[model samples]
Target: MNVGIVAAGPVHDIPDLKKVNHIDYWIGVDEGANVLYESGIQADLLTGDFDSIEPNRLESIKQNTKAINQFSSIKDETDLELAFLEAIKLKPTTVYIYGATGGRLDHAWVNVQLLTMFAEKHLDAWMVNSQNEMTVKYPGKYELNKDLSYPYISFLPLSEVVNGLTLQGFRYTLEDQDINQGSSLTISNEWSEKKGTYFFNSGILLVIKSRD
Candidate 1:
């Protein structure tokens, strides 16, 4: 099963929700509930402080969703994080997060960090928008299949350094290399074959597959 979580980020950055409506479960946060409501989509869980959402839309979401987790505006975590917490509880095989990027850089950064946290729990999660998809991988090997929709692949060290990093079947292959966080050593590489393989021994790495 897969769960899709949508937040209250800029609507222009979100991809077509209709394409992901088939997910087994859906989570909406703050004005993201409004997005689902307007799109005629139903969410399994609705969570947020509801500060950014209109009362009518919020009420509609509360009525349509299986449950609503209302939090105060003064809560510790962001509305999106709360919805993510609810989504992870379902233990979906994969979690797709939308409306999480392309607004405030701080919020986007935190949401990207959330992917690393979920990765630590062995959850397959990704933060996606119209033009980009962000994935965090722990210390392990990963296979990325070739996709024309997203041709450029970049790797960024999530920690101070990612050690023993190896890449195969890519335009720029690496063998037992160490990538530092601030280094742009592995960026804008394309798969030379049908698939590319990457493995790292320690530290988390952010794998971004994107295009203009």
Candidate 2:
């Protein structure tokens, strides 16, 4: 299955939802249901406390959605996280998250952490917004496609250090280099060749790519 999750971030900057191809399922998190509706995209499932939406809008969403998973305002996981858990249960081949950025810093950070959760479960999850695409990487080899339109790539260590790191086809090459936490060593590396590869032996990394 191919699933798409919509969070509570600003939707005005996202591309036309109708232009997307082969979307088998759509999930709405909190006010995201309203955003989806405004974009003329129907959601398969709605999951949230309805706190962010007005009473009438919430009722309309509940009535229109195929399924609804309501939670109390006081909950451990964020609405987006809950949506992700539900999406994973369906065993989707790939999951795309919209409206994940351009929100509260805490919420954005938590959503970024969700990528790590997906990585742990061996799921392909990514945060896609108007300007950025984000994913979490564990120790392993990664093959990256070079998008000439958006060639800038950045890697931020999630742990104290990412050990034994190697980079190929990048402007800044590293072989068995250690990247410490809070370090800028891996920032803004461009693809010199058609593709790029990176391998790390330990720790987690947040990989972000964006256009100028």
Candidate 3:
């Protein structure tokens, strides 16, 4: 199953819902339920503390959604995190997160970190917004295709150091290189060919496909 999660971020940053393909289930986090409601999408589940949603909007969501998991504002987990846990319980094959970026910088950063949780479970997940699609990758070889919408591919180390980084069919190719966490060497590379391949021997990497 493919699960989609919507978090409370800037609504303008969300991609057009009509074009979002293959999402079998949707989970709305806090004010994000209002987003789904406004877009005429029925949320399969709504999970959040809901401090950000207005009373009427929350009531509307509660009426339309299949299930609701309302929580206290004093909970330990963030609303997005809670929604993510609920998503995993469904055993989705892939998870796509929207409204995860482009509002508060702190929230965006934390949402990026949440990708690692999906990775730990060996499930595929992506954090996508208007300009970028981000995912976490472990040591392995992978193929990437050129996307006209998101033309740049960047690899940033999530670990202290990523070892044996190599790239082929890229504008700026690397061979057996080690990149540090803060290194910008892998930023803004384009596909030299229609398809490119990359490999890393160790450490976690944050792969971001983006456009300006």
Candidate 4:
């Protein structure tokens, strides 16, 4: 099953939920419930502290949502983390996260780090917004198709180094290279054909598909 998690970020940064395919369940976090409800998508579960959400909206969400998992405002987990824990119970194949980026810098960066947990679980997880789709991958071979909506692709090392990095069918290709953290060597690449491939022998890689 595929699941989507929507968090409280800039409303405009959230993609049109209806347009994403194969989303079997939707999890709304905090004010994201209002965004989902306003977008005409009822959430399967709502998990958050409710501090950022208006009381009236929370009431409406409670009425329409399938279930609720409310947390204390003083809890250890952030609202999004709570929502993610809820999502894990469903055993989804892939998780698409919306409204997670374009917020406070710290929140956004931490959310990016959260993708590593998904990677550890061997589940596909993406942090998506209007102009970007981000994911983390382990050492392996992977393929990508050209996406007109997100015309650029990038890879960065999440670890100190990603060894034996290679690229095929990309405008700026590499072969058997080592990319260190903080290196801008793999930024802003484009597909040279209908599809492209990337591979690395070791370390975690941060991949981003984006547009201007």
TM-score of each: 0.96, 0.93, 0.95, 0.95
Instruction: For model 3, give the 10-residue run with minimal summed lDDT.
Output: 115-124
Clashing pairs in 1: none
Query: How should the candidates be ordered by lDDT, best one leading?
Result: 3, 4, 1, 2
TM-score, candidate number 2:
0.93
List the pairs of residues colliding in candidate 3. none
Q: lDDT tens digits, residues 1-212, model 4?
A: 99999999999888887777779999989888898888888899998887877788789878999988988889777898878777777888989999999969999999998888788877789999989999999988988888888999999999999999999999999999999999998999999989999999999999999999
Off by over 4 Å in 4: none
lDDT of 3 by residue, 2-78 (tens): 99998888999999876787999989888888888888899999998899888986887899999999999997889
Model 4: lDDT of residue 200: 93
Candidate 3, residue 15: how far the Cα is off, in Å: 1.4
Cα lDDT of model 1 by residue, 117-137, tens digit: 688778888888998988999
The model with the greater lDDT, 1 or 2, is 1
**Model 3 ranges with Cα > 4 A deviation:** none
The local distance difference test score of each candidate is 0.87, 0.85, 0.90, 0.90
**Full candidate order by TM-score, most accurate first:** 1, 4, 3, 2
lDDT of 2 at 97: 93
